[model samples]
Target: MSTLTDLRRSMVAEARRRQRLTWLISAVVLVALPWIFSSSFSISIMTQIGIAIIFALSYNMLLGQGGMLSFGHAAYFGLGGFLAMHAMNYIADGAIPLPVPLLPLIGGVIGLFFGFIIGTFSTRRAGTVFAMISLGVAELIAALSLIFVGFFGGEEGVSSNRTKGPDFFGFNFGPDIQVYYVAAFWALIAAIAMFLFSRTPAGRMANAVRDNAERAEFIGYSQRNVRMISFCLSGFFAGLAGGMFAIAYEIVTEETLNMNQSGAVLLMAYIGGVGYFIGPIIGAIIMTLLRTVLSNFTELWMLYVGLLFIATVMFVPSGLTGLLMMHGPAWKRRSLKRLLAPYAAISIPSLAVIMGVGGLLELTHFAHTTSMDDRVMTLFSIPMNIDSLLPWAGLIALFIGGVLGVRRLRPMLLDAWADANGAGGGD
Candidate 1:
């Protein structure tokens, strides 16, 4: 058994090492994805992903690593977005430097300014009290957005043009693809920076404070200071993400400063898995994909997402990243291979059923603008039509099959997860 354990550990270590290399290669691939793909829609998706990635990491800084929850996070995001837009206008009008790539810095400063002011009070209390104070803060700022029409632009919001910047060797950000690269670059940078922050001493101290405030204080770390630092850092990066938004869409509105944006970020970060950095990245990617791609398919996407969120909270508290990681031991033992066929069998049909229903619903409603329109996108060029009773019958059959497979496989998956954890006393 010890030999098997050693072998498993060695194999796992080897796999992890290879995964690192894979990631590096994948990062390069992603950065160049714009050049490779000719679709303008793809670039738009990538830009949304970029903004989401930064936003998720920033939220995680509050919830995941810091162990604090703030329902009013949108205040900073909106402020940052608003300020960045102003910065863009300043540059465009020759009031500031043209080709302003440092717009995120301006956004961060705005976020930190608020964080500095608010942290003075909110950092005093942790948990529920802290959450409420943050909510109040968000509401206050949201109200302020309406009142301060001159700066915030009230209901009309603020807009800017990126082409107003200086031409860098005659490369104007006139095209969406060019802007996509800039967004992707910043997204990657923000992700790497946030990941590094988690490994920093301050970040670890935040974790210590989160897990046990009394013990962290007992160890000579000021819990107050720890919380303050976390709040500020979270605001800083969130502002940066907001800046990305301001630049990406060229607009900042009350909606940005509202509870909905904050709630979306909270949901994304938490559902991705707060305990893991990669979790938010995954969460952000999934949410953005759903928002940009799935929503175009069906208005009912939110309903399904809500159901999935509830299911995750109830059954998979750790989110998708954690659930996937739960299979580590079985993977190490080479036993996980046995389940691959079953997983594919279940997942493929299930995805088809879910996405098919979603796609058909959108077609009926005429909500989508995908390349896969009924008139253009035919399966095997057979002129498939989903606007009929036959397609509905197939959908019903698929749904029933997926439900049955999931119910049957769920218990087995749970057992395997338990085995994986117990096998190595993994936390």
Candidate 2:
């Protein structure tokens, strides 16, 4: 009995050590990131990424941990932004003397209030019924935004001056870099708080209810209460994120509360891997990069985003993080090195396939959309006439070759994977 207790204590101590190490590393990285990329544009992008990380994490609290698939999560986010904007305006008008940095608390409180009200009824049922109710609530709120011109500002939405709030420690936050630091601080705090929440008994019961509500109820736990608590907490974090958005942009528009925003957050959470705590953070970063960087390069960025999401769903249902986690067993066994060559062999053909498909998509889009005088289009820096057949033929050949090569090398990859996982002869 003493040995067992000692072993458990050792394991708990080890976990705490790892947790501390992780936070220290995260802090170093966050502090160094802005310096590494000091450009104004880069800082702006980083600010957006920070906001996205908070939003995605909040969404995961519900969908990933509580088994709640909320279709209108953005409602809380947008509402928070709107109310935060109003608060900022009031500060500007001298009606309120609050500091700008602390205004997100108002958003959090409002989100909690609405979340409690919504969750009271929504938590009565789970799964599809809850999802439908959320959708209806989101739609109703969206429609009201258009109708209530005083607060929502009609189609134009509401705007504010974040700099008007009382200065914090002699900083008015007049620059983007200053705002980035503030966002970074909040994001780190929110993340740490959510992580701690996940360790609490309420969080554990939420998970229990998520996995098996009936069993949780049998154990005398109210599944509805567990869900309501999770829902409200998720909303609070989301509202906090929305408040950050208002401070960063100084505007809260109808687009902020729309279905598109909700869908985007959902995609980020799912693509990042809802099963893991760090998954949404990765998803938020990747998606923000895609939205900002990729959109600058291509008009068909949304199409690419859709394709990536579909592929993730079909091939990597557990998400990118899940795919990464799958290699852990092999790494622990020191067998991962065996699959390196096979992965490299498959990667070349896969790259070719992706390039070929992108070429075809661009060419097809150009051919249908470009004027006769604008027939020339560039693929991989090579100018090709959209009206010509040569580019079409070349792209088709490349795609076919890539397809055949992938098929031929697939067995090698399979054999390598099996070997690494201790299911095959090769070692």
Best by TM-score: 2
- Model 1 residue-pair collision total: 1
- Candidate 2's residue-wise lDDT over 328-351, tens digit each? 988988999999999999998898
lDDT of 1 by residue, 11-103 (tens): 979976875785687579777788776598988898888888888888889899888898999898899999999999998998987475668
- In lDDT terms, how accurate is model 2? 0.91
lDDT at 351, model 2 = 84
Question: What lDDT score belongs to each candidate, Candidate 1 first?
Answer: 0.81, 0.91
Highest lDDT against the true fold, candidate: 2
